[model samples]
Target: MTDEELAISVSGLRKSYRDNQAVAGVDLAVRRGEVFALLGPNGAGKTTTVEILEGFRQRDGGDVSVLGVDPAKAGADWRKRIGIVLQGTGEFDELKVGEVVRHFARFYPNASDPAEVIERVGLSDKANSRTHTLSGGQKRRLDVALGIVNRPELLFLDEPTTGFDPAARREFWDLIRQLSHQGTTILLTTHYLDEAEALADRVGVINRGAMVAVSTPAELGGRHQATARVGWREDGQARFEQTDHPTDAVRRLSERFGGEVPELTVTRPTLEDIYLEMLGEKEEQQ
Candidate 1:
């Protein structure tokens, strides 16, 4: 995409703490209105890379640009254009939900209505509730409310759904979709592979401070091109085989059985499968 079409761009990003090389020669680019997911295991430098992009931490070397300005040189105005929802809850336990949201809105030049943003995050019922009284999931919703109160052009979400139940997670997924639909650029970092699969337009995987792969959920780790596993039960025994053409295999099995193949299943590799395979390969290399 063109320069005007990009929200974030980085080249050869490097960072270190003493002898610990957290990020090494990383390159990343995010479009103006896309939900990009960064997936990696613990200590894979994902947090370091994101912190550098968010201007919270400085890098050791290489170029970095966010919203057309170097994050290292970004000022208050630059910050107003970006939103951040960290992995932990905000320290506003003494304040009511609405109070917290309204307080943050004052920091931005053109902030959204605190009440509207609170309702947008499904927190209207808790508007008068103290921040400390909220359940874990409710606190997370408050975090999201604060993140979008500025109506930012770009949002950074680091494990935003960590404390949610399955139903709450699904609801948060819908909220994320709504934001992406409204032309907000989102950079997400999450440990849940399924969350990335459900929400991201594109995903980049990092390992040991290096980028391993970047692709759509369906095609990552060559998953789309990988062989399908066909399985069936025959004569009181279970059997399965990997084949390029699952349909052909199933058809032949149907004919052999002279009818529907009993307990037949044709399945492709799942995202978790592909992810583990990639990690295993990386470990072998080390």
Candidate 2:
């Protein structure tokens, strides 16, 4: 896609602290209206790159654009076009949920209604509760309510569901999908491979300050092309064969058995499997 169509664009992105390079010659592009997930282990420069994109930190070198404006040079008007939910829960313990949402709604000229935003994030019932009384997952919902209350064209989520239970995490994923369906471009950073698989249109992996790969969850690290494992019970033993075409292998196995292959199962490398392999290789090269 063209630069105009990208919500974020970075080329030769670099940053350093004293003698250590936290980010090194990284390149990335996130398309408008698409959910993009950035994956990396701790200290892999994911935070640094995202901070530069959010204009919260300055990069030592590289060209960066977010929402068609250079974030490093952005002003208040530019800021209104994007929203961010940081790793920490931005809370006012003394305020009610509705009151807090209303306060933040005033920051943007085109902000959505406080009540509606709260409801959209599934917080309507807790609107009158004190911030300090909410659960961990509720705090996260409140954070998202504030983030999208501005009706931002782009939203940044940093470990959005870190402390959420499984069910709450799934609910948050649905909310993310609703936002994307309404034309919001989302940039998400998460350690959960399943989260990326469920929410991202495309996922990018960064290792040791460089982008290792970028593709759909199923295709990352050539996962789609990777060999498949076909397993079955044979002659009182469990046996399996690794091949590119599992169907062909299964067909031969069935023919050999002259009937249904016993306990047949076909498996391919999962997203986590491919992700770990990428990180392992990157570490070895260093």
Candidate 3:
């Protein structure tokens, strides 16, 4: 699919179980070949929303389309073009890593080469190892390898790096970047704000089953243009001020000091900071 086309679209999506609403009137659109991140605290309905799009669950009310076909009415061919890496690990513990990936590759009409897939996910060295013997990070890589074995045009990654260490997370991010470069549309949900900032082209924040905001990481909650906090040492104590124009503040400070301002620092809100503030506002509103 071309980058301009929408891979998935949802409008007025609502799901309720008896008296509790899991998803409440949500609208989302994912562009082809883009890495879109859905961020929110637990119980924010992110899982439910993704399930609806994946055709695994029924929605109470909404118009949902995936790859130009309504997910609720999608056929086998429609399903073939998508891949899902769920929160849970795979269950082929007894099989070798290559055996597991090769087995899944058969399910798709046109699958990637098993060896190539393993190498792509950085599992080449462990390709002969048994799945049960792999470490947590290795197991997660096995999951990813299986997910893309089908060569799906769209992929869903739900907390794929949950058990990964810092080094492993960085390596996984590189793998994701390679997939995106190949024009694979991805929908990612993760608790790591830094991951979203590093990988996503755009981010959508959902809270209490509702989307609070959608924008680039820098622009979310107007963070890119938000007031900057300037701090410096003065009279043996730290003094700080917030202003929209930090350049002017720095210039003034420099003039006052006739040189560098001691311990000077200018900071803007980070993605996590804005995200937490948005969640706090949502709580206050309720």
Candidate 4:
């Protein structure tokens, strides 16, 4: 598929289970070779939306397309071109790390080498170790290796780095970067705002089973030109003011200090701050 074609498309998507409406009138579009993030609180219908896109669940109403075909009608060839790393853990208690990877590799007609995939996820040293013996982070890496073993055109990562430590998280980000560089479209869902900022080309924020906004990380919540807080120590107490022109504020503070402002800091809204504000706004509207 060319870059212009949408890897995922949905319009007025809706899903309901019994009396509960899980997803409601959602619209989304994801471009090829882009890392798109879907973020929302628990029970916000994020899982249901993903499951529908993955063809694991049927939507109650609305149009949906994945790779130019309706997910519900897409066949095995369509399934082979997509990879999914679910939130649930894999069961390979009796198999060695390499053994499990190799086992899965055989299922795909064009799979990545098991050894290479293991190395890519930083599990070369644990290739011979039993899968059950690996740490939480290591096991997550194994899951990732299995997901990408087919070298799919599109990948769905659901809370991919849930149990990772700081170091492991960074390593996992590198792997994601590598996949993106290879022109693999990715759809990621995670609660980590920083992760979304670091990886997603575009992010869509969902709340109460509806998409609230969609934009690049910098543009989300009006963060690109949002007011910045400028602060400095004055009379042994810290004072701060929010302003759109932080440079001018700093210049004025510099004059007040005759040179340098004491403990001066110009802080812009971080991804987390902006995300929280967006969520708050959504709540108020509801």
Q: Higher TM-score: candidate 1 or 4?
A: 1
Winner on TM-score between 1 and 2 is 1
lDDT of 1: 0.93
**TM per prediction:** 0.98, 0.96, 0.96, 0.97
- Model 3 per-residue lDDT tens digits across residues 86-168: 88787787889999898889888999999999999989999998899998888988989988998889999998888789999
Model 4 Cα lDDT, one tens digit per residue, 1-286: 4425899989999999999999999999999999999988899889999999999998999999998889999899998899999986786997999999999999899999899999999999999999999998899989989999999999999999987899989988999999999999999999999999999999999888899899999899889989999999999999999999999999999998999899999999998898888889888987
Write down the worst ten-residue block by lDDT for model 1. 86-95
As for lDDT, the candidate ahead, 2 or 4, is 2
* Model 2, span 1-286: residue lDDT tens: 8887999999999999999999999999999999999999999999999999999999999999998899989999988989899887887898999999999998899999999999999999999999999999999999999889999999999999998899999999999999999999999999999999999999999988999899999899999899999999978999989999898998898899898999999999999999998999888888
Query: Of models 1 and 2, which has the larger lDDT?
Result: 2
Clashing pairs in 3: none
Distance from true location, Cα of 190 in model 2, Å: 0.6
Q: C-alpha displacement of 142 in model 1, angstroms?
A: 0.5
Pairs clashing within candidate 4: none
> Candidate 2 deviates by what RMSD?
1.3
lDDT per residue for candidate 1 within 1-286, as digits (tens), equals 7778899998899999999999999999898999999999999999999999999999999998899999999999999999999978776878999999999999998999999999999999999998999988889889999999999999999999887899999999999999999999999999999999999999999999988998999999999999999999988999999999999999999999999899999999999899989999999998
Candidate 2 error regions (>4 Å) = none
Full-model lDDT, candidate 2 = 0.94
Candidate 1: Cα lDDT at 92: 84
